[model samples]
Target: MTTLGLIGSGHIGSQLARAAVAHGYDVLVSNSRGPDSLSELILELGERATAGTTADAATADLVAVAIPLKDVQNIPADLLGGKIVIDTSNYYPRRDGTIAPLDAGEMTVSEFVQAHFADARLVKAFNHIQAPAITDDAQSAGTAERRALIVAGDDDDAKKIVSGFIDAIGFDVLDIGPLSASWRIEAGTPAFGPRRDREELEIDIAQATRSARH
Candidate 1:
């Protein structure tokens, strides 16, 4: 069984947990506030879910970083090494403060995260969809109208791993090139909010314009 580890229990993280459990994946969720703070969420997630430290969650088969951009520094470097990490963060200057490389358009949000978690296999995914849509719109495999999620990553094998999990969780994936092209589906772009199928998503990704890295 695939155990999905979540490093943030906010809207996106928690919703991702629900979708993971819906697909019968065991989940270990953690937040900066500590495991004790996540007890209620764990109870809601039932036996398959456990409240773990960030390091604990990092050890799972796959880990997703869904916290606010500013919190990226808190991610456990040593524990996340060798794990496939999903980068679900958007860099908001107002909330996260401005990053020089990002502001200069020289690097992307995924690149910023890559610099921090260099040892981990990073895949940029699950950042484009709205939190509520993740659960409300999930469809079983082969469903006719499955939604699509945009994915960008550096490693081919790593992207394939996350792609399989995304399929299992009810969304078809659009591999929109590498991590550098992550800005295509980032927040505020055409591919960011609306639920779209693979074809429509492909169009959106192609028509995407540069927006705030947030």
Candidate 2:
């Protein structure tokens, strides 16, 4: 079983932790508030789940970064080294304040994350979709049809590792190439949060072929 680590205890982080626990993965959750503060959530998640400091969570086989985009730099560089770090953040100028380059379409959110967490195996995923939808694994298993999630990373092995986790959570995985091509999955793109069926998602991605902003 994968020992999952979460580096934020916000909505997405907390919900994803529950899903991971439900799927039988051992989870270590953390936040900026300190490990002791997460004791209540840790207790709710049961024995399979535990709370730890940010650095401790980052040391897992796979780490999910669910922090606000602006605060991502606070994550220690050494902590993320050589590990798969899942990015589940979005650029919300009002709440997170403006990121000039991101607002200008000069850099994708994932690219910014990679630049900050340079040593980590960064994968652009779980960003376009909403956390509520992500929590609903049953949405992926029903006959009514569910959408595929985009995953972009330079490393093939890391992408596969993340894809396996995606599959375990009941969603289809769409390989959108490397990190440089992540603009295709960023917010404001047509593909972002489109809960269409798998075939629809593929076609949507294929048809609107604009050059992704570097």
Candidate 3:
């Protein structure tokens, strides 16, 4: 009965909640708007899901951050310290405003999130796929050509935990090295968006080139 905490209940967050509940994990869903706003979502998620404050969600066994990049600083860092956090954020200058480092190609979005969550075992995942794809594209284990999702983190154990969760929910996990190498699949890269299985994904990662930041 592991609890999966969600720090933002937007498209990605809500979709992940549905997937987690279907897989038997209790979910604590929260957003900047507060628990009351999530009542409709909670009822839709049925009994295993509870709407709570961001702080309460931060205390779950695993936490998923699906907020806009500009709002990352507002996440409860103190409570999330040492937690295995799955970061599913992508930087959009128009939406999140321009971030100097990211705009200059000096830091990956996940790295910026890591700096903020300093002590959290942060893993970059779910950022490359469409929000609906979170549940729609899941395939059982051993399904031939099963779609693969990429995960990057500095912690081996944390990556393993997140990878296991991804596998259970339907998809193969491809570790693309540490967070530093995560840029290989960021927004502009060939690895983002399109549905790719393990072999195809590896090729995309290899072909990834750092383009001038948008």
Candidate 4:
């Protein structure tokens, strides 16, 4: 059985943990507040779920990062090195403060995160959807109009792994090229929110345009 580690048990993280457990994956969830703070969540997740330190979670088969963008620096690099990390974070200047590259439209949020965990096989996902929609809107594979989630990463194998996980959890996967091109689904883009199938998502991606940094 695959172990899914979560590095932040906030809205998105908790939802992902639920989805993972529902699909028979053991989940290790952790947050900045410490394992004791996650006891309730673990109990709710049942026997398959365990609360652990961030480092402990990082050691799982796959790790999902659901923390605020500003705190990416706080993630332990040494432990996450060479791991497949699903980055479920978005950049909001108001909350994360202004980043030069992001403000200049030079690098997508995923690129910036990749730079921080240089050795991790990071795939940008779960960032474009709402927290509640992660499980609520999921549909089985082959279901007509099944919601599609976008994934962008520099590593082909890493993207494939994450895509499979998405499919298993009841959604379709849409690969939107590399991490550099992930701006198409960033917060301001048309593809960011809403539940769209593959075809509709493709159209939204095509219509995405970067507004002036200001």
Candidate 5:
């Protein structure tokens, strides 16, 4: 069984934990607040899940970074090293202050995070999906049908690993090239959390993908 670690047991982290357990993966979840704070969630996740400190959680086969963008440094580098990290964080200017690279269109959130955690195999995912939508319903619901999940990473093997996890959780995986191209799927973009059907998501990602500059 793949051991999944989660740094930051907030909305997305908790949801990912739940989904992972639902798919039979062992999950270790934690936040800045400590394991005691997540006792209830751990209990709810049953034997498949456990709560630990942020650093401990970062040591699993797959680690998820779901905390606020500004606190990325708080996650110990040693823990994130050599792990495939799923980045679901976004930069909220009001809370994270002004990030010049993001504002200048120079780097996406995952690009900055990857630079900070150089040893980790960083992949941008869960950032484009909504908390409620991802947590609720198996894939899609109502008239919407099911849409694809977009993932961007520099490592093909790492992306394939994350893509398998994504498919297990219910949605189709749409590979969106590398981390540098992640800006198109970031929060404010046309493809971000649009709740489009699978076909529509394909179209959105296609339109958003920029051509390589010569």
Candidate 6:
């Protein structure tokens, strides 16, 4: 995708916008407060970036749902139909309260988001990352100590596209299988840390166990 669209301008969303711009993708960033509220971030992102409504941003080539896990339903599905959506949210009961089904392990957080945006191709990413670490730790693609990010989705083509974006934004990618398998990298897993290198992540993903409970 030539343009990266963000539905939230918090830590993860802001960093993604900066990284996307640096990597040659124009970005449209939005927050619940509206475009006027994003003035500073737009200036920080420079010429390639613009502030728009959630709907406007959602219309771009690819969209990242970087809002809180409880807020996914607020994004209109009409704008996401047939689009490749990157889901960057993690469920923290202390923050998002108890999403019973998710807490019970009936489905991964990404699958829950997929149900909210049924027509969109949802790929889970950026959920386990800490933005401060991303800013300090990014390594060029093949650097020996480059860190890795896992993308989980059922759509191969959609996963391929998201993987390219991850590589461009300065990280390696490991397809940790489908969304059904995403709990392996969820908040409590080994792959969910703030300081893991590629080698470390390889071990983490491999050692990931099936937990029917998050």
Pick by lDDT: which candidate is best? 3
lDDT of 5 at 62: 90
Candidate 3 residue-wise lDDT at 112: 92
Which of 2 and 5 is the better model by lDDT?
Answer: 5
How many clashes would you count in candidate 6? 0
How well is each residue in 1-214 modelled by candidate 5, as lDDT tens digits? 2989999888888889998998889999989888899999999999999899887887788988999999997766666788899999787889998888777777788989998899999999999877767757456223356667888999999999998888788787788789987877776667887776667877887677532210
- Per-candidate clashes come to 1, 0, 0, 0, 0, 0
User: Which 10-residue window in model 5 sums to the lowest lDDT?
Assistant: 205-214
lDDT of 3 at 187: 90
Please list all clashing residue pairs in model 2, or write none if there are none. none
Question: Mind sharing the TM-score for model 6?
Answer: 0.96
TM-scores for all predictions: 0.95, 0.90, 0.97, 0.97, 0.91, 0.96
Residues 1-214, model 1: lDDT tens digits: 3899999999999999998998889999999999999999999999889999988898789899999999898765566888899999897889998788888778889988998988989999988888999888988878886899978999999999999989998899889988899988776788888889999999998898885443
User: Global lDDT of each model?
Assistant: 0.88, 0.81, 0.93, 0.92, 0.83, 0.88
Residue-level lDDT tens digits of model 4 in 1-214: 2999999999999999999999999999999999999988998999999999999999899999999999999876667899999998798889999899888988888999999999999999999899999889988889999999999999999999999999999899999999988989988789989889999999999999886541
lDDT of 1 at 45: 92
Tell me model 1's lDDT, rounded to 2 decimals. Answer: 0.88
- Candidate 5 residue pairs in clash (backbone atoms < 3 Å): none
Off by over 4 Å in 1: 211-214
What is the Cα root-mean-square deviation between model 6 and the actual structure? 1.2
Compared with the true structure, what per-residue lDDT tens digits does model 6 show for residues 106-198? 999999999889999989988888987656667787888788888999999999999999988888888888998898888888778766776
RMSD to native for every prediction? 1.4, 2.4, 1.1, 1.2, 3.4, 1.2
Q: Give the TM-score (vs. native) of candidate 3.
A: 0.97
Error of 2 at 171 (Å): 0.7
